[model samples]
Target chain A: MLEIINLHARVGDKQILNGISLQVRVGEVHAIMGPNGSGKSTLAQVLAGHPAYEVTAGQATFQGRDLLDLEPEERARAGLFLAFQYPVEIPGVSNAYFLRAALNEIRKARGQEELDPIDFMDLAEEKLKLVEWGPDILSRAVNAGFSGGEKKRNEILQMAVLEPTLAILDETDSGLDIDALRIVAEGVNRLRRPDNATVVVTHYQRLLNYIVPDFVHVIAAGRIVRSGGRELALELEAKGYEWLTEAVPA
Target chain B: MSRAILQDYQALHPQGAPQAGWLGRLRQRGLDRFQETGYPTSRDEDWRFVDLAPLTGAEFRVGGDSPAVRPEALAPYRYPGTECMLLVFVNGQFVPGLSDLGSVPAGVTVGSLASITARQTELLGHHLGRYAPIESSGFTALNTALIADGLLLHVARDVQVPRPIHALFVTAGDPAGLATHPRNLVVLEPGARASVIESYAGLSEGAYFTNAVTEAIVGDGAVLEYLKIQRESERAFHVGTTHMRHGRDSRGTSHSVSFGAALCRNNLDVVLDGPGVEAQMLGLYMGRDRQEVDNHTSLLHAHPNCSTREVYKGILDGRAHGVFNGKIYVTPIAQKTDAKQTNRALLLSDHARIDTKPQLEIFADDVKCTHGATVGALDQQASFYLKSRGVAGPLARKILTYAFAAEVLDEIPFPAVRESLEAVVMARLNARGE
Candidate 1:
């Protein structure tokens, strides 16, 4: 569902993601394990069309459409969703109202009738259950004063409601506990199906134990230095990334 | 109009007038003060940032006895729900035929200042311009001199009026070189609580000037919630001043919203004289095209143990300019006073500008006062966040601006006002092609 060829991206004047290429097919979960400053987050930001990340040289295609040319919102409407590593805190806007507005935007783009408040509430309730979230989070300001675990779970809840074809989970397990991590991974697993895909980016192989991936790639110096099977994540966790970077010919 | 105004000032301020009764003496004294002060200039400290060039050069006559606008023409100014009392003014003249006070509670008195000149004359005598300074304020004095009639409302002691009183002011006839003045007096007796909504709207397509003043007195332990909304034609010029004095233990809240005009300036001042008095001053403005709006607010803590809060926000589009100056004063006797203020603006265009100033004068060392100001475009990061959620660019801007204003609007406790204000804000935004 997604393809990248020699992606070169930068945050301001400093280039973060060098030439990187990867592909994820339908019904497959691609796990990218990298250490800090490995450009794993940069890849997700570039894919999400973050304005701060300029794609200087890259050819990214999603569902047969060129992705780099579209604006962030256009890319989102074209079936792309990024679960932010750190969710933004939007004060003065109720979580429920903001989420509904987002859902309606996506629905409207699909030539579908927008969901009224009643229907929206029903859908929101069902989706909240995916992450074991409750109605209490609905009235609170968007992610304001939210606990780390609650923020992670809220990201999953938004994904379930948006139902993007290509979902990129950017360090969703970073600040989550074991229980919260499992709930988030399970939510992703439930949404998985043929003709759709998920990409899980994490620093550790812990979250991999919950949401199994068909392929694993270790990113270093902005490129995927190694590609292996699902067991490769465990092998890297055991050996660490020092040898991987050393193995890359200097 | 200038000649007539100068003539009246001369008549009101002849020498030896102070030797007469206190009222006559005061008027004569005020006349002399007016002669000495004449009119405020931008060079003055208080008017340093205010540009009165448009009003200075313009020649305008006092609004005369022209027939009121048709009822259908005033339909847009009406509000829904039960109105305890309604007052309508056309060209500064009271319109009793257009007013309705059937919903007022028993023992509450609501009448036109022109009609009940006898019974309310004494009450008006004691508190006319004494609560404010008309000598230095050209618009305030002009309104006082030419004001044909206005509103006088008194709520009995301890009575809580469940419904709000609506006051609508409209100007008729082409305003080629004419102006109107309307004065409103509102007094909430001891322990009485009420809400008043005053709207200044225009029906004429001409450039009329509306110079109005509203003075309010909150009796001991009384609570007053007042909202002033201004929606004038593009060619109109509006200058308004509101003076409020809170009695001991009384509470006052004023929310002012303006949609700009050719030239609009508002001076809202409050004096907290009684202990435990609390006051809240809030303002918001949304302007498009070449409209300009300037708002100045002052709060005085005269006695001990008082609290005050102020928040003002503005959204400027095209070449619109916005100005905000808020002053908070704490006297030596006003120990334990707590004051806070914030002014923020969103400039939608490169040329749009905002001048915000917060002045605090504290003679009491035991008081706590903090103020903040900011001017910026929409948050680029927040806009991107919403865009990534599938919302379009224009919709994203609307959401951000709405959230910015919601900081003040959300804290309102009344649901009806909250909903109505939301609708009004949304409609105003949509009118700007949002």
Candidate 2:
């Protein structure tokens, strides 16, 4: 469902992601684990078409469309979603309003009928339960005063409603508590389908335990150094990133 | 002011030579002050940032009795769903013949300054020329000399007007082929409450000048929610001043929104005379093309246990320029005063400009006073976030900028007014493109 071929990207004058390649087939969940300086988050941001990150070389295709050529919003309408690691706190804009705008845009792009406020609220309520959050949070500004856990859950709520064909969850579990991690994982797990793919970017192996991945790739420096099945996550968890970096030649 | 135009215009109205007595004395004193003060040069501190050159060069049209005001002519804004009294004025003179006073509460006298100038001279004397009529500025002298009693509003003590009073001043193409002045005095007696909607509306496409002044006295414990909407014709020029004095425990909220006129200048001067007073001034301005809007606000906290908060936001597009100077003054006796102010500007076009200064002049050492000013474009990241969610670029920026201005609008107490203001802002944003 999603493919990256020799993807190399940079942010301004500094190159961040260098020669990284990965593929996720339908119905499969992939976890990319790496150290602090690793290009794991950069890959997610580049794929989402973040303006800061420049794609020096390589291409990413989602659903047979060249995703790199599309703007961030265009990529989103084409079924590519990026659950931000640190969701921007937009004061004065309510969560429900933001979500409705997003939903209407995507619907319009796909030539589907738009949903009114009443129907949009109904859909949002259903997805709110999937992430274990109530309507109170949406009533306030978008992530204005939300807690770390609430922000993470809000991201999942967006993912569930959009139901993207391919979702890139970057550091979703970093600041989340165990319960929030479980709720976010449950939301992602529920969206799993035979024709959709999910990429979970994390530093620790704990997130993978809750939302088990079919494959795990260890990233170091600017490239993916190792690739293995789900067990590889457990191995990295026991042995810290010290051994993982040593295994990669300078 | 050049040596050529330095000649006093007030010479037309000589010193009590042939006039109507003591009120004649005010006109004479005002004229003398105008001659002595001359035209306010930019050298004056108050007129420092504002350049009166354009206002001076723009054909200085004077008043003359020619074409009569027609009521049916004010078809542009027939504001419906309003139970309040409506006062309409053309140029500077109040047209009682064109107004609809309907059923005003007793003791509440609302009329044009011309009416007071002729009939109720005693009432006009008590407050007229109370403040410095002629500022040290050049334009101030010009307005003093040209003004024909803008409008008069007097609410007796404890008179609670249940409905709003809409004062519509329309600047039309010259009756005498000249400019106009709309000066007003609004005095809310002790314990009185009222809502005033002062609109600077346009009538013609002529390059007319609408120099206006509104002096309001918010008496003891009185609450005034004033909204000034400046939607003048792009061909007209506007220079306005709103001088307000708050009594003990009084509350005043002023929302000034200007979106029209070739060059618009607003001097919102408020002084908290009594203790336990609260004053909040909020405004939003949008400018485009060569249009210029300068908002000069000063809150003088002279008493103790007072609070004042101000927020002014400006959105500049094209090559338009916006100037915002928000100053808060805390005197020595004004202890335990809580004053906070913020001036923000969002420049959409690279060629647009904004000069903002959040001035805090504090003499009370124990008071809590804070001021901040920020000038920048929309948050690119937040716009990207919205765009990434499939919202168009222009719409995303509009949403963000609207959200920014909403912070100031949220301070308004009236929900209906808030809704209308929001709609007006949204419409303005929608009409422009990136």
Candidate 3:
């Protein structure tokens, strides 16, 4: 479903992701774990067509389409979603309105009929229960004055609404409490279908307990140093990233 | 040519005309002041950024016979709902057949200024020119000198108006170089409460000028909300001045929305005359093409314990120019006054420009006042965030711009008004193309 070959990227003068390669099939969950500034989040952002991260080298393909050649919006329309680590606070835009716009945009791109506000609300009401949030949050400004946990839940809510074919959750578990983490994970877990894929990028293995991944890759200094089964996350959690850093070739 | 225009206006009435009396004296004073001030040049501090050459160069004749307009033609501009008394005017003259007062409650008088009878003369005389200081600006003085028609609203003490008053000014004609001065006076007695909406629109595409002034007095403990929306013909020019005076413990609010006219300038001055007063001023101006919109607002905290908040936002596209000058003055006796002012502008094109000046004059050390101004394009990150969710680039820009303008539009207390304004804003954005 997704493939990245030597994905070398940079922001301004400094390079971040260098010669990173990854592959994932349908119905498979991949977890990319790394220390701080190991290009874990950078990979997620670059795959989503973030303009700040220049793709200096390499090619990426998603569902047989050139993912690196698409714009951010084009990537989204192509069923690629990126749950931002820090969801932006867009004051004056109601959450319900934002969600409806995003959903309708995706629907229209796929040659499907757009849902009216009333129908969209009905659809959103069901998704609201997935995040254990009431309808009041829909009327409030998007992530304005929201707690850290609420922002994470909002991101998960977007994931549920858009229903992308491939989603990259970049450190979504960083700011969430244990309960919020469980709710977000459960929401992601329920949306997993045989044709769609998800990439969970994080620093810790606690999230894997909820939505267990099929593959865990340890990334250091912009390169995936090790690839193993899900047990690799537990080993890294117990030993810390220092052991992985030392094991990587200089 | 300049002298001929004012000379022709002054020639409309004879000197010491018996019908004029005190109004004649007031008009004479206004005319003298206007002649002395003339049209302000860019060298003047207040008029530095706004160029009035297009407005001043045109030879706009004084009021002529207003063209007849059907009541149904104004249905679009009318606010939805039942709690409003509609007063329609064409060419600055009240259209009685189109107006619907529907038996206003006792102590509440809503009528045309030209129709103020002998019994209501004292009421109009007391509050007409008191709040609007004519010596401050040439436009106000000109409006005062030539003002002969507009809306007159007066509410007695302790009387809460059950319905809002809607004053609609529609200019319908292709009359070349036509001009009209509309004057409005609203007086809410002690403890009285009411909301008033003023709309300025044009029925035809013509080169005309509308110079309007509205003076409002909110008595002690009273509450007044005034909304002025300008949607004139693209070829027309509009200049409006609104003055509000708040008495002890009174509250006042004004929302100014400008979206039309070749040249538009609005002056809003609010004076907190007594303690415990609250004043709020919110404005949104979306200018495109060659349109130029300027808003100058001043808040005077004359008494202690007064609070004032102001937020003005502008969206400029194409070669449009937007100007905002917000001034807050806290006097020595205005201790403990709290004042905050913010002006933000979004420039969608390289040629688009915005000149913002925030002035704060504090004479009292105990007051808390802050002012800020910013000019920039839409946040690329925020835009990308929306676009990343499947929203296209153009839609993303529209959404972000809409959010910026909503900061002021959301402050409008009336949902119906806010919704209609939102539609207008969206249409304006869409008209700019993808």
Estimated TM-score for each candidate: 0.80, 0.78, 0.87
Best by DockQ: 3
Model 1 ranges off by over 4 Å: A3-23, A30-43, A54-61, A64-69, A84-161, A169-190, A200-250, B6-36, B66-72, B81-84, B173-176, B303-305, B332-336, B411-421
Residues B1-434 of candidate 1: C-alpha lDDT, one tens digit per residue: 35766554445446665435444454455555555565577987777665777776777676557675778887666765344477888877778788777766775778787787677767778777777666648567656654456777788899988877878888777766667767788889999998888788877766778788899999999999998878887778888899999999999889898874687888998999799998899988877787888889989999988988899999888888888999898999899999999899999888888888888999999988999998998777778778878976677777788777766676555555555666667776667684
Chain A TM-score by candidate, in order: 0.97, 0.97, 0.98
Predicted candidate 3: interface RMSD?
1.3
Instruction: Kindly report which residue stretches of model 3 are placed more than 4 angstroms away from their true locations once superposed.
Output: A4-22, A32-40, A55-60, A64-66, A89-154, A171-183, A202-209, A216-250, B1-16, B332-335
Candidate 2 DockQ score? 0.50
Ranking by TM-score: 3, 1, 2
TM-score chain B for all models: 0.90, 0.90, 0.96
In candidate 3, what are the lDDT values of residues B196-253, reduced to their tens digit? 9999988888888999999999999999999999999888999999999999999988
Ranking by DockQ: 3, 1, 2
**Model 3 chain A, poorest ten-residue lDDT window?**
A241-250
Q: Report, to 2 decimal places, the DockQ of model 1.
A: 0.53
Using lDDT as the measure, the top candidate is 3
CAPRI-style class, candidate 1: medium
Model 2 chain A weakest 10-residue run by lDDT: A241-250
**Residue A85 Cα positional deviation in candidate 2, in Å, after optimal superposition:** 5.8
